[model samples]
Target: MFEKLSYLQLQQYWWFLVGTLAALFVFMTFVQGGQTLLRELGRSETQRDLLVNALGRKWELGFTSLVMFGGALFAAFPLFYSVSFGGAYFVWMAILFCFIIQAVAYEYRKKPDNFLGQRTYEIFLFINGSLGIFLVGAALATLFSGGHFVVNEMHLSRWTNPLYGLEALANPFNIAFGLMLFFLSRLLASLFFINEIDDEAIYARARKSLLRCTLMFLAAFAYVAYAIATMKGYGYDPATGAVFAKEGKYLQNLLAMPAVAGMLLAGVLGLLAGVAMTLWGGSRRGIWPAGIGVVLVVLALFLTLGYNDTAFYPSLSDPQSSLTIQNSSGSRYTLVAMSYVSLMVPFVLGYIAFVWRAMSAKRLTVEEVENDPHHY
Candidate 1:
């Protein structure tokens, strides 16, 4: 069945798969968000250990999803992978460093005679939770806000700015998106803790944190969404396949793709409902709805960026260098081969879900961690 589609169809199919993985990666960032709250929610060493172990169990899942997201991009859209990862070296390097520290921290945090000490490792997790997530959001924002790079006839790319994409910090819109993700992650983390941990104190603190993070997330999300709606976005000419600037381009895309718009709406409402149920109704299951909501919202945004002849990655240095799926995709044979491989994704996800369920079958407790010989 997969053999029958046109090249463009395959490109779009892979783009959709990439977008889905990206959305799942963002959702998995609840692990990062939970990292930031370890000290705040866990007042005692035992409590802190509980939080750490709970998060450590799932941290590798987030890391795995991240690796998958990058691998998919590299395989399906090598040009974009090269242009952004190569040209924006500093930003990507910083992100990589943060994750590296995170891996080290998780591995050695509870190890005997560790050189760095537990506090230092905890600080590293904080850096990953805050700085790492923020950098990711800002980097993604450049997809819409455009990046400082030029692509040559050979499809080689060069960074125009000296900061090597660190300049994205200068744009408030990018920062806004970063802040939004940071708080959203925190909110999701709070909900997850409420569901997964059996401690009453942690639940109380998570509830309070959820309220605060929700407010902060709403503020940043509103600003970013409004800006995108009002801002001039990159457009593509279907006949000529050229990139150009169009006012209210994103807003128009939402209108043009009503189904995408509906997804966004449903996602926002789902998020709000999840928060409300947790804050008022005292529902521990808020994470389920809220997590799915985040995925949907992020997926809609990605679809808007890539579908409808939109330039998913725009080049500020050269509009003509903007990348659409058609321009940035791998050859048809590669995509077809990858599509066959993509069939394994569902089974992989199902296995992950099974493992997650088995691991989380019982709520985590201080006694359990104390009894277990090995703990993060």
Candidate 2:
């Protein structure tokens, strides 16, 4: 069926798949968010262990989804992957280090006589949750704000700064975007705890933290939204393939793509409604709506960037060096082969859903965790 589609169509299809993976990964980051909640919700050793075990159950899933997201993007758009991964070494390296330590923490946190104590490993999880998520958000913001990279005629890319991707930290808008995702992750983690844990004290503390996180999430979102709404965006001419900065380009994309605009609006409202249901309506299932909202919002944002002739990875060092789906995609033969493999995605998702249901069949309890021989 994909044989009939044009090269551009195949690129769009792969980008859609990549974007979906990314959106799901964002939702899966509740694991990272929950990592940050180990201390706040868990007041004692057992309590902390309960929280750790709870997050541990799903950390591998989050990590797996993240790897898949990156892999899909790399397969679909090798240029974007090479440019960002090569040029943004510092940011990506720090994120990679955070994930490595996270793996170490979960594996050895409870091991007896491990040179570093459990608390040290716990700190590792915290860094992965906070700094890691923040940097991921900042890295994503570069898609909209553009990066300081130039691509030669041979298509090799180079970073324009000594700090490499660490320079993203210098942008206030990037920082706000990072903070937004960081707090959003924490908020989602709280909602997840409210849904997953059976302890009353943990639930109360989770709710308490949720309220503050919600406020912080909204504040950071406000700043990022304002910046996006006000910022000039990169666009390319379909005929000539030259990139240019247009005033309010992102806003124009939203206006031009009404369906995406609707998704964005629905996503915002759904996210807020989920918080209301938990905080006011006494609903434990807020994670469902909130998680779905995160996927929709992120998916819509990604669509806005990759669709409508916009530059998904704009270049500030050289305007024409911007990477779009069209310019950065792999050859048609590669995309077609990948497209066939992508058909198995639905079956994989079905397996994940089955496992998720089996795992969460009952709320996690301290007693259960204490008795389980395999508890993290």
Report the CA-based lDDT of candidate 1 relative to the real structure: 0.94
Runs with alpha carbons beyond 4 Å of true place in candidate 1: none
Please state every model's RMSD to the true fold in angstroms.
0.7, 0.8
State the C-alpha lDDT per candidate. 0.94, 0.92
Model 2 error, position 174 (Å): 0.6
Each candidate's clash count: 0, 0
